[model samples]
Target chain A: MGQYKITLSGEAQTAIVRHGEQAFPFECCGFLYGHENDGRFVTEAMPVANNKKGDRRKQFEISPPDYMKAEKYALGNGLQLLGAYHSHPNHPAIASAHDLALAMPYFSYVIVSVKNGKAADIKSWRLKETIEKKFAEEKVAVKHMAMFSD
Target chain B: MAKIIIPTPLRKFTANTATFETSGSNIKEAIQELTGAYNGLTRHLLDNDFNIRSFIKIYLGEDDINSLQKEDTTIANDSVISIVPIIAGGC
Candidate 1:
């Protein structure tokens, strides 16, 4: 299997962290839109409401309708739906058992740790193709764009 | 024939093909034709009882099948169907 990695644009990173902070005490979820070249390049982060019912502090759900919409949006913008990102309120930025159970191959799972209503650590993971169904951490590269005045 | 759009995550099971054509009359039959062509998709899309998995969602155009008659939802020749997996998880 090839090594997997994802690069997030500065704006995309800010959008993800902000969404996590805004949804403090609960999990926030969204989709990552980008294209695959040498590796995945995330240019946009589109936040979607967590549709999971009942207790949502430790879980988040992205309805199929929402995913459909995200796909359409990405296609319209000439990009691909690379994967999804979600926040872990008051928890570490790690994939839990629940995450591994629902994970699919080829999609990067980004987890953000939110501490006291603030965004902390962030990591990305991908499911291994083995029968054991395990996740391996993917290298994350954040591009900080410089504001230039011309 | 109706067109079934396979999401990226599930494309490996479909030989990396993004869309499939089926002549089934309804959603159930369409899926039957799909899984028939791609045996690897059977376990991922359906359970032991041959029911659509809870995490798998089928949409006809922009509307979810659950909003319609579900498996019985009929499809037109030009209809476009989408198979989207539920995105859910936490820490």
Candidate 2:
């Protein structure tokens, strides 16, 4: 129903893929930051620890405080909270029903598919607020700019 | 019918099902139907007053109930309601 395009630095892309590979069996989750107004153009990927007590391989959870901290940090700097990122271990990079259930409308959810402890496919999705609830894929525009902020 | 989603942590109480179908008109009614239909959910979802606990956050579609009317947020038919618990504390 609707679509979003995000610009991530090459360094930011490497951070999330590396985070996914290093976590391997466990899932890694993080938030993306960038300036906003026209569209979300993520320039940074900040990986945080997955604190979910559930199966890490299947589920990744971010505490509310972590969100607050990320928001504070992003605002303190000169950026906005663009979206979130997570790795799906041994699963395809597709938005699950669970992801859709928890997705916020304006945020890009980047899901990296890790198979056999290696990053395979990467995809971004957003929950579209159309007449019908739809999970739509977003185009990720990787920029070659120098890293904005680690 | 609106869809009420249960997070993974609470799935053990919902027979391992992640989603349930309900015909609740509002968020409060939907959650009430959820806890009432499922066993072991009443305590986790509500307090002794049967009010939704603070830690549990409900989202109607993409809007959080807190930004809406809390428990009184309206739910449309075929809406996806996510009952996400606010995971906080601990390292």
Candidate 3:
């Protein structure tokens, strides 16, 4: 229902591919590392296991160690947290009900859905609020970003 | 032939495929067959006792597997079984 021009740099593409591979059958959650000045964002896949104690609903928790490392990497590169990424397993690359509820105000959400072992599809979304405001202000523009496979 | 829907995380264990035609006559047999095929997926779906882990839920044709027959639930040839991992996220 929301529209925006989402660009993915080569690095972001690879990061997604790697994350897709690592979190097979479950959701892979990680952060997008980028800075305003860099003109390009690089995705670093952080390994986070699902913390669903007893429920089979899709859940994700960035491991503390991985989180710290991502934070460190972002800080060292003067990049900001560009967005978050996760996988959809067999479902389509659409945001689930849980996804919309957990989304913050201004961040990109990348969903990678795998069908039959292959990365079937990928898509991006800005929070609804951001999408609405972009439409209102006519600034529906987003910078390019890439994912690293490693 | 039961339609087994694979979750995204477990795809790696399932040869990176999503849904597959499983040849198990029932739900338990089907899952067992799948686990037998993908050694790494057994741990994520079943615990040490080989029981369905509390963290995973199975749905058989829109019905919750727990209320029906749990893992022993039978699978119709046309049934669609989904294994979706309940995901909990931290800010």
Error of 3 at B55 (Å): 20
C-alpha lDDT of candidate 1 relative to the true structure: 0.90
Candidate 1 per-residue lDDT over residues A1-150, each given as its tens digit: 237788999888888898998999999999999988777999999899999997789999998888888878876899988899999999999899999889877899999899998888889999887767899898888888531112
Task: Show where candidate 3 strays beyond 4 Å.
Answer: A1-3, A37-40, A43-47, A51-57, A63-69, A130-150, B1-91
TM-score of each: 0.91, 0.61, 0.48
Sort by DockQ, best first: what order? 1, 2, 3
Range of the 10 consecutive residues with the lowest summed lDDT in candidate 3 chain A = A133-142
For all candidates in order, state the fraction of native interface contacts they contain. 0.77, 0.07, 0.12
lDDT by residue (tens digit), candidate 2, A31-84? 888876686677889999898897787888887557656756775888766678
lDDT of 3 by residue, B7-51 (tens): 544565778676878878778898898888888788668878998
Clashing residue pairs, backbone N/CA/C < 3 A, model 1 = none
**lDDT leader:** 1
Off by over 4 Å in 1: A145-150
Model 2 chain B scores worst on lDDT over the 10 consecutive residues at B82-91
lDDT of 3 at A3: 46
- Number of the top DockQ candidate: 1
2 against 3, candidate with superior DockQ: 2
